[model samples]
Target: MITGDALLLRPWREADAAELVRVQRGDAALRRWTGAAVDDEAAALAWIAGQARGWETGDRLGFAVVAADARNCAAEEGELLGHIALKDVLSGDGRAEVGYWTAARARGRGVAPRALTALTGWAFGRGLTRLELLHEMDNTASCRVALKSGYERAGVLPAAPPEFPLDGCLHACRPGA
Candidate 1:
């Protein structure tokens, strides 16, 4: 687990399924950005399970961002604050892509950047030399988070139709930078 000043980043749990569904259903920005369809408990559970499998395979590492006040409680007992992950990881590769979304109620509290900073530090500690963060060009909030978390604007990624209809801003960061 990774702890920040006001957040705790830990593994996703089966108990988080209901909260995940509720957050995705109620947060329009999340739906718009992620295009996730975790509308029911079953779907949420499947998604969580996939995260676990990713851990077992070392291809993806996902974390459930929760309030630090719940640190003493079980991982699932914490108030769900957001989600973050390092995806597309390959063994022996020093690069990975990072992605995250904040719960609506947790916005403006520096949750995303704090959790991201902690995660980036942990990743680098594990020998990842570089990490990339990408977000739709219009997502100024994510842009800010990237900048605050030490990622430099690299370039624009051309749109890939259907899934990504808009160009995206590519940001990159390296250890100790």
Candidate 2:
């Protein structure tokens, strides 16, 4: 389990499937950002199982955003905050693409930035040289996360979405590059 001052980034477990489904359904922003469909039990279970397998094989690393307040969940079933992950890892280049989302209630609280910083630091420590974050041009919230996490604003990629007129900013962070 990877940790930070106010959050914990732990590997996914089978027990977390139910709570994860709740989180995903509850957070519309997450669904929009990730384009993940979690409308039914079967779909959610399939997604969770895929996450567990990815963790087991070292293909992808996923993290759950747990708040620091112990009583938060126990007393109030506290906020899930959201989730973050490093995907499409390239072993030879030591690079990975980062993605994240914040729960609706958790928005504007800097959850994304904090989780991003912690994840990127852990990735670099594990020998990842370059971390990349891409987002739709209109996603101002994500731009804030990238900027606050020390990512350099790289130029836009034309014809990115192909079907949609989605121009995006490619933010990058390369430690000791």
Query: Could you say which candidate leads in TM-score?
Result: 1
TM-score of each: 0.94, 0.86
lDDT of 2 by residue, 1-177 (tens): 666656777666566667777777756667666788777667767887787777777768877777755554333233467778888774578889998877776788888898898999899999998999999888888998999999989878664454435887899999854
Q: Write the per-residue lDDT of candidate 1 for residues 52-161, one digit (tens) a residue.
A: 99999999999999887655544435678999999988856789999999989899999999999999999999989999999999999999999999999999999998
Cα RMSD of all models vs. native, in order, equals 1.5, 3.2
Write down the lDDT of every candidate, Cα atoms only.
0.90, 0.77
Highest lDDT, which number? 1
Clashes of each: 0, 1
Candidate 1 structure, TM-score to reference = 0.94
What 10-residue stretch in candidate 2 is worst by lDDT?
A: 70-79
